[model samples]
Target: MRHTLKTLLLCLLLPSAQVLAEEVQVAVAANFTAPMQVIAAAFEQDTGHQVKASFGSTGQLYAQITHGAPFDVFLAADDSTPAKLESEGATLGGSRFTYATGALALWSAQPDLVDHSGAVLRSDRFQHLAIANPKTAPYGMAATQVMAAQGLLEQLTPRLVEGQSIGQAYQFVASGNAELGFVALSQVYRDGQLSNGSAWLVPAELHDPIHQDAVILSKAAANPAATALVDYLRGERAAKIIRSFGYQL
Candidate 1:
């Protein structure tokens, strides 16, 4: 009787330990950090799986995935990267889906530095305006598109400070290295409220829509934890949390 009880306890604990050992590794876009962190926390609480996330420019993450970076999922700031991965067989076909739509905003740490009308971009109050590197960062591409649409690209080029990623661009302005910069709306918020800063939400008409996407890597489709993470992302609870972070569905 004692032996049978011990055997039963071991068998029960073994499956739980195996589940706990499973972890999903995700490569995430910088703009999605805040919401992803919240989503990850909630996922772990609701499910036993753990997620390890690495945040960076979508372009950089794409390169890493192509070179076999061991990422189970790729959450990009734009649809292009995930689409590319799917086309190249790096991701599971048909697994790509738009997760969020990001918004761009001109932000400044200084009070009243940026007006609601975004007149500060044309003002001489600041010598430099930080933007992400358009060639690499999706937010940078959007910023460039906005400037071009407003016919300010040529004029603003001379005063631009380029950041490798949107997060870095936000840091440039937040640290006062640049008086104002274009950043993701998600970065300026905490618990659904804007942090200490002045900002102007750029109109969507100013640029192409930022349709963020996520995909399961082809190599990880069989990974139980990876599949669970993807399912969690599509579930109602995760979607609600993402929406609360200023992301558009």
Candidate 2:
């Protein structure tokens, strides 16, 4: 312990001193899993801070947070969650900000399966259609809203397969367990284009805008690493990664 203290003191006195590494626990929405992983890597490289991320549906994470889970930051799939946390005094005052605006996609691993216009929904083409649980995932709510706007939710209800989170919903389609699924556009897109299979980008008008927000938890309000992580999330470096995944910055 003395030797460690001496090293820290020496470093503090040195001209080329490095900051001590700090770890932050972040609760992330499932839809942002890919980008968050990439961002966490970049953040650690840029700063000597470590990030411990937990991914789940926004509602699930929010519940855990309200129940005193020791998460330092909350990255929700919907803006509402952050606002609710703020209202409930779970987060630092005025710490919320929209990090990304998400878009939905009708994705299928089969080529030429989902037409761009989504007319395939009317036809009896596939057996299973997957969606995340609407009660938990905001993307699932958007998916149902899109179907309702297209007047196909009732017809499609009988064939629906539900996943616990948006990431799982994507898995169901990617693994071919379901023929087609309502997934975040980011899951199927990379470098400004669809990465694989067939996908129909859902029209923004069909559902409300998915404004994902981030907030620093009150429990971590004084933690430098936690604040840095939240700041890094809204920075250009992370924003670029987010856009590459097809999420709106």
> Model 2: runs farther than 4 Å from truth?
1-21
How well is each residue in 100-190 modelled by candidate 1, as lDDT tens digits?
A: 8998888999988899989888889999899999999999999999999888999999999999999899999989999999999999966
For each of the candidates, the C-alpha root-mean-square deviation to the true structure, in angstroms, is 5.2, 4.7
Model 2 TM? 0.91
The lDDT for every candidate, in the order shown, is 0.90, 0.92
lDDT of 2 by residue, 1-249 (tens): 999999998877764322322778899999998888999999999987989999999999998999999899999999998999999888899899999999999999999899999988888899999999999999999999999998899999999999999999999999999999999998888889998999999988999999999999999866899999988988889989999999887
Clashing pairs in 2: none
Model 1's alpha-carbon lDDT is 0.90
- Show the colliding residue pairs in model 1: none
The local lDDT score (0 to 100) that residue 121 gets in candidate 1 is: 81
